[model samples]
Target: MTDATDMAAVRVDAPGTSATARLLAEAARAVDAPDLVLAVSRGGVRTVHTGGSAAPGPVPRELLTYELGSASKPYAGLLLARLVAQGRVRYEDRAADLLAPGLPVHPAVRRITLRHLLTHTSGLPGLPADFYPQAVPRWSTGPYGGYPADRVVRAFLRARPRRRPGTRWRYSNFAVSVLGHTLAAATGTPWEVLLHQQVLAPLGLDATRVRPGPDGTDAVGRRRDGTPVPALDTGGFTAAGAVRATPLDLLTFLEAHVGGPEPRDPALNAALTEVTRPLLRRGLRHAHTHTLTWFQHPSPYGRVLFHAGATLGQQAFLGFRPDSGLAVAATATRRVHRGDTFVATAYGLLTETP
Candidate 1:
């Protein structure tokens, strides 16, 4: 198994095979994810990052530190599916059954099942209103700075249903975070341990770990104003969003989902496919469509399995065409404006083949 230090030296050698490489390289320069971008293919991998930054220098392909943000949901969904396959839990199991007793106060919430939570059909809002700060941080840094799990659970208990369970689609971090807690309770293991054993270790993804940087090791990037923003730990929300992985490790995981010929547990693979499948069409009121964990956007290329993440000033994007077996993963230090240049570049790569 390779350690983070060894992985940091890994780089892409297949630049010529990817027709999108030059364009992606240009996009990486445009956004400030350390001016770094990685494009991976079956034959090889290529990395491009702008120079002249901190002492650690440019972001290395092997320095395993990336905040996956909501990208962790797909992994969480896989773990739940594994429990289902083991007969330890069922998709139809209600939230009340999985959660600590008497926690949910809403009558309608009792009807929410594991599947509903995984698919974001639990009718729960994105984040509890009480947790919302009236003012944005002067500088966008670790938005969920002090919010902890206990506070999250307290706010959730007081939450009323936005729509009946399974009636309409609404994204809820509270729901997924609760799902992680529930899984931990059912299996009697830390959520991170479960992920490492079931997902990372199985695929030989040694660099992928739940903690921000294994033993305080991390990659550095600058904020928009040219201030160095060290990677911030997400605390207990690791299951909901705190996963740090290198582009190669991420590509390895995506390859498994896209049917790359790696020895993966059959049950886990099936669960991955099931989760990525479109569960329901959200009402028009919501701005976008969603799959179990993936955000769906119609492109001329085909349906794309994609998720974008933001933490403090850092932003990341992962997208792949499962049918075409092509994937692109990009991260930036400065928050790329939503629907900005980075996204456009990612889509351009997804649609164009080598």
Candidate 2:
């Protein structure tokens, strides 16, 4: 694990004056989030906040690892961009060209490009309704319990399009999950290993790993009730939202986006542009516009790039202003309402000066 003490030593300003911290502190308290960590780089800031379990006093930072939810989409976008940068793939290539021959996708679906998947314009739903089984516990160690990869592919093959590709924006976990498998086929490597090799290893993110704990590695928080939920078996959707990491490690990632050193392949810089660029306007109501993976909002400080993630009991947000080299990440155990509270808390943290 990276030294938390060393990360704390790095000078980062809070989002706002004392007021920013106070606002965030209020928000944190309101949501019952007890443990919060924030890191700012250049002109941006990132944070992780966790609500305490009723049984325990307060959740320890080291013990809290929540599902990133759709936040994992950005990493998937990065992986695809990396392939494009390496000449292994192209953005315009059809999905059928990359996957095996047996996929039963609609003819229009086959024409869907990698860009559509990254942009959430592929017209796939959040998850196939049939995949949801009442037998599965509401809050498992792994969010997608028992839904293996083969099942996911089968779901995709049988899926009927709600809208033609690129005509509209609809968030879809199934689409990105398919993208992960497509990358696996194109690269001839498991998506998990490829992500570590291409993104985490190069960045020196030692604490970030797929599937929380395997061979005695220390994992994050247990069940909300403190029942010590076993490590989640991600089954096949690991690439979608199964990776785990500490707040400080995530801060390091945000730092790299705002002019930090290229920890992975230098070629990754080219890929960053494709992944971060704002491609479409999501109808979702927010102060900012949505990009391929990141969200953009016009702050007094400048344009801010941000994204949020949520599962059963975990909530996370990453916000940054590239022009000012400022970034902020915030994670919480309880899901907070999406609006001024979340945006204000994130922006206030980003505006803080060390």
Q: Could you estimate the TM-score for every candidate? A: 0.84, 0.81
Backbone clashes in model 1, listed as residue pairs: 7-62, 8-62, 12-45, 12-46, 33-332, 33-333, 142-312
Cα lDDT for residue 181, candidate 2: 81
lDDT of 2 by residue, 1-354 (tens): 223325453543344545445444555544434334443444333333333434333434534454566677677777787888899888787766677575666876777777777777887787777767732564454557778898777776666777888888777777788888878888899998999888877666777777665443433333345344455455666667776666666677777677775555676777777766776675646334777677676767777777776555455677677777766767654444344254355556665433
lDDT score of residue 76 within candidate 1: 80
Residue 4 lDDT (model 2): 34
In model 2, how large is the Cα lDDT of residue 225?
50
lDDT scores of the candidates, listed in order = 0.65, 0.64
Regions more than 4 Å wrong, model 2: 1-31, 43-66, 102-104, 134-143, 214-233, 284-288, 335-344, 347-354
Give the range where candidate 1 is weakest over 10 consecutive residues by summed lDDT: 43-52
lDDT of 1 by residue, 161-193 (tens): 868898877677778877777677777887889
